[model samples]
Target chain A: MHEAITEEKWDIVIEPRSSLLSINWKEIWHYKDLLMLLVKRDFVAFYKQTILGPLWFFIQPLLTTAMYFLIFNKVANLTTDEVPPLLFYMAGVTCWNYFSETLTKTSDTFITNASIFGKVYFPRLVIPLSIVLSNLIRLAIQFSLFLLFWFYHLFVTGKISPHWELIWLFPFLIVLMAALGLGLGIIFSSLTTKYRDLRFLLTFGIQLLMFATPVVYPLSLASEKYKWLIAINPFTGIIETFRYIFLGKGDFNWIYLGYSCGTTVLILFAGIIIFNRVEKTFMDTV
Target chain B: MSGNAIEIRNLSKMYRLGEVGTGTLSHDLKRWWYKTRGKEDPFLKLGQENKRDTAGGDYVWALKDVSFDVKQGEVLGIIGKNGAGKSTLLKLLSRVTAPTTGTLKAKGRIASLLEVGTGFHPELTGRENIFLNGAILGMTKEEIKRKFDEIVDFAGVERYIDTPVKRYSSGMYVRLAFGVAAHLESEILIVDEVLAVGDAEFQDKCLGKMHDISSKEGRTVLFVSHNLAAIDRLCSKALLINRGKVVMENTPKKVIEEYSLTNYIPGEIIFEDNRFLKFLSLKQEGNNLKIVCDYDAPTPLEIPCLGFVISDSMGNKIFGTNPNYQPPKTPIKESAKGRLQIEILYPKLLNGRYNLSIWFGDGKVDYVVMENVLSIEIINMINYVRETYATASGPVSPIVEWKYDYKD
Candidate 1:
């Protein structure tokens, strides 16, 4: 009994720093219930006071798709690879909205939740992770709307032919976009704690980043020399590969999809490292 | 559970002195450069003590080599002046921020109540927020469900449990938030002045809950508060910290007595390093009380009035004096800076303990005031005639002239 006391076995030993790459995944797993609850908080409260409520989830992409079709397709005459204009714009809108909304909201994690972070102790990663999940729910609603239009066009017009064999790559692409957003978002959130001007830059930078992605214009329409530049964007391969699988007339394929996956892993890994360093002391700096 | 619940060794937290933007990037770059070169932090050597009002270097050590240990089930009361690093210590223990140096080893979950209602959303109803805040403080959903009714009953906001917290009055909101935190099940609890809120009755209820958490449940607790009575009543042991260091650790009564004496050291009185009066002393000789004060002044009458009050143990003013009523050669203002002192002789006072507080003013406004600067106790006293008074009848006992005439 005396030997079994295990006097030195402490459940938690906190120090000034931990290794940059070392993550306490088990500790985070312990707080999964908190993660789910926070996800509910974020997703449910987003449109709480609105008239239409969660229906706005479907309404938002519909409105954005119509607006983009008017400005980009009807006025500018940009091609959507000959897919029905509304369906084409809706797909891009749904996919891009997930990435952009998740990135923008998750990047404000530190600043927006400083009060909570300063007061209580939980897995700091829970916040950005919850944001990702909440945005995924929004994306799911918008994706169904897009899928409704796609099914209508596939059966009625019979003009668009989807590559059914490549359909397995669907959920993987959503995950890639989510990972990329979470990674970059946490990094920016960690950084903006010190340099507040990054916030102002990020608000517009995400907007400009949409044009960089092939959201409105097809990757095929990009000029020869600068096409490589657009391809450099991780989202380019993702959005293009998404269109190629469903719309069946895209220029990108599996190689670009692989490249996007690699980029997601790299950015997400770096983002976690930065976030781990920042979360401990962001309360003071913020 | 029989061993130490928490052990902190040389914990310290350093903070930058000024605003975070602009020069911070360069400092970060420089620190990164040093880290790359495998050198110690460059600015680590430059910080001074955490004296808030004083101008110091660009860095300050908020908690400097603070080390303490708590046995399982021991309730330790932390008493300190503001900015004395009590909050920093609690923050480190709660893992709110990592320390700049040193290690903290603790067993089991530790929940810290730095502020009540820490993540409570205004839009969340009282019931929803109970679940949300319970989860935030490390309670699972099932645990919150079990305690939900108890928390509501404790807060006595049962009628408005479904109402959004934004609609509750300030007192009601504080009560509800505190009720949620009080129910959190953890091995160790760190509370920081959270009982200072709510009405007095609710504060007592919170204190009672805290007492039960430590004594009845056998959990370790670290309580920080300025209320000495609460500390004395609740804590099994008390610690006094000053200037980011542990000044004393002893029984609550002795530690509190020593803490009160920090403002008035024997034979000298200095608060904030004698910012107002350079020297102050009160003494009793025979039947007279001697009050001497010295302060800095550029010219005579810059400080026109100086006085002290003698209050009973209950803080009721028994007697006081100032130079306003009488004129003296070489006025108090002219006699400041060590030239003169005031000595007053009155009829012998009753035997009782009294407190002496001093103040300096310019006849219109007080420049500085400090309480508990001196405490005087009078014992047996012989008046003009040889009559011994063992105890006090009134603040002052005076000899009265009497004749043989009886109601004539």
Candidate 2:
């Protein structure tokens, strides 16, 4: 056993690396258990003291849907492509919450985990990735509530119908949302570590982004002159395509879906590059 | 397969001083501009040594081109005064922050206990925190499971294992944190003054555990601490750092001796606020100690006192003497230079370092009070008690008369 130990070579060599592409994928894979435990911690810690516990997960999107229904559909007279207003708003709220929650939580990964990061050495990417995964659990719960309302409207009113497009399009839309959220979250997190100005801008910026996306109002209600303005948002394609797939009333544009996918991949790549670079030396500044 | 477990080559870390945000943007922009033109960073040359006393530069090198090697299973102690780059070296070794310019090649995993219980969440139960802390220390779930019972038992918190750590007392919290860190299976362990916290018993327990890890388990350990006795007991090899540079690397005894001597500031003006009395020298001659000072009395006083205090290395006062009780024969008057010498019989103190504080004043008004003016190393010149071993049982060894009466 002693001879065997002596024969083994060095396992790790630390150095001042200059390359932005020196991400250690194998080490991340090696620490997959840590990533999962972090996800579990986030999920459990979020509602540890709440009286309602996981019920808040469902109640949050439900209350938001009600508020949106009252303000946008009833007051502003916004259209929902002939679908039931509750179903429309619930669908939008569920999908939009998943993206926004993931983005907001993951964006604070470095700041929130600074104590842990400073004391230990693990793949820092594990933190943002865990945030993305944990938010998915909340999204899943909220999505179930949306599905319950959708099925009720389907049978009782016969106003909305399911589309075959959802079989492939639904998963694609979810992936797109997850990627975009994780991407933008890490990019802003990396920048915020050096200059905290971006942290203050992110809260209001995400709120404005929600309005820019087709969440409360249907894409078909957008005027032709302002349609491109909405289309410019990467989230617009995903949310609009999600409504189109589930309700079969909103327009489905393959070109827009393709554009959203491309943007997701681009942002995700850039975010990882920046995140990798920042993780190495963030302890110095942070 | 080399014997060296860690080889550090020209390791350095530079930190920008003051507001890092406002000035960083412009510096970054300028760096980028320079990089585009294929020139070296313009600001790299301005970094000075990290000296807390003087501020002259915008950047300081916390660790300046330090290179060292640690053989396998060596217990290396890093000793330095505050702001001496000891913690910064450990930080760089732990990869908490990357080096500014250097390379470190190491064999096997490294675990750094910079502080105990680094990632403990107060909301989590003791059992849950064990898993969390274990995972943060790079243990997998299966490994944590294997060591779960052992960790709880070692921490001696089995009764409250399922309760949240917030409810645990601070001692229990440190115990649990230390238990998790002690069970880490990393080959190289970096500890930074963690034993300074917790109680004396627990600190001794940790020192014992570190000894076991380095000797029996053959794990390489780098420990940094201000406790010289602890370093002397635990480390075979020690490194002394000063002003972000390694001043000496030698055996622990020699390094600690050199450290204490170098830290001693002799023939230096410790204080000069009033300047009514100026201390000259404190010298030890055989069994007698002499304190020389220059006294300048602004006005004649009824009783002027000259006093001195002697304290051990840990700053515990052993004894003090003042002439006020006996009263001096003459009063002092103002003069450009008036030398005064006071000699007292040195106590039969044990072999150790002691600090002397000198003061000269009238009965009520104080003229000068200089703290820690001189540090003297006492050596046992004669074994009067016939005891070869020098154990400091008390502050002073006094001869007491012994009387024995015959009893049936």
lDDT of 2: 0.82
**Interface RMSD values for the candidates, listed in order?**
1.1, 1.1
Candidate 2 per-residue lDDT over residues B71-186, each given as its tens digit: 99999999887788988898888888888888888899999999999989899999999998898888888889998988888889999999999999999999999999999999
Clashing pairs in 1: none
Instruction: Write model 2 residue lDDT over A165-220, tens digit each, in one string.
Output: 46686877888999999999999999988899998899999999889888999888
> Residue-wise lDDT of candidate 1 within B216-329, one digit each (tens)?
999999999866667877899998888888888898878867765564224355444654567777665566767777776444455457777888656888777776756567
Per residue, candidate 1 scores C-alpha lDDT tens digits across A1-286 of 8757644788889998898977888988878878888987775577667788888888778889889999998899998878888878887898899999899999999999988898899989999999999898888888888778888879988889998888898888988999999999999999998889989999999999999988998889989989988888999999988888898878776677888899999999999999999888887788
DockQ of each: 0.64, 0.72
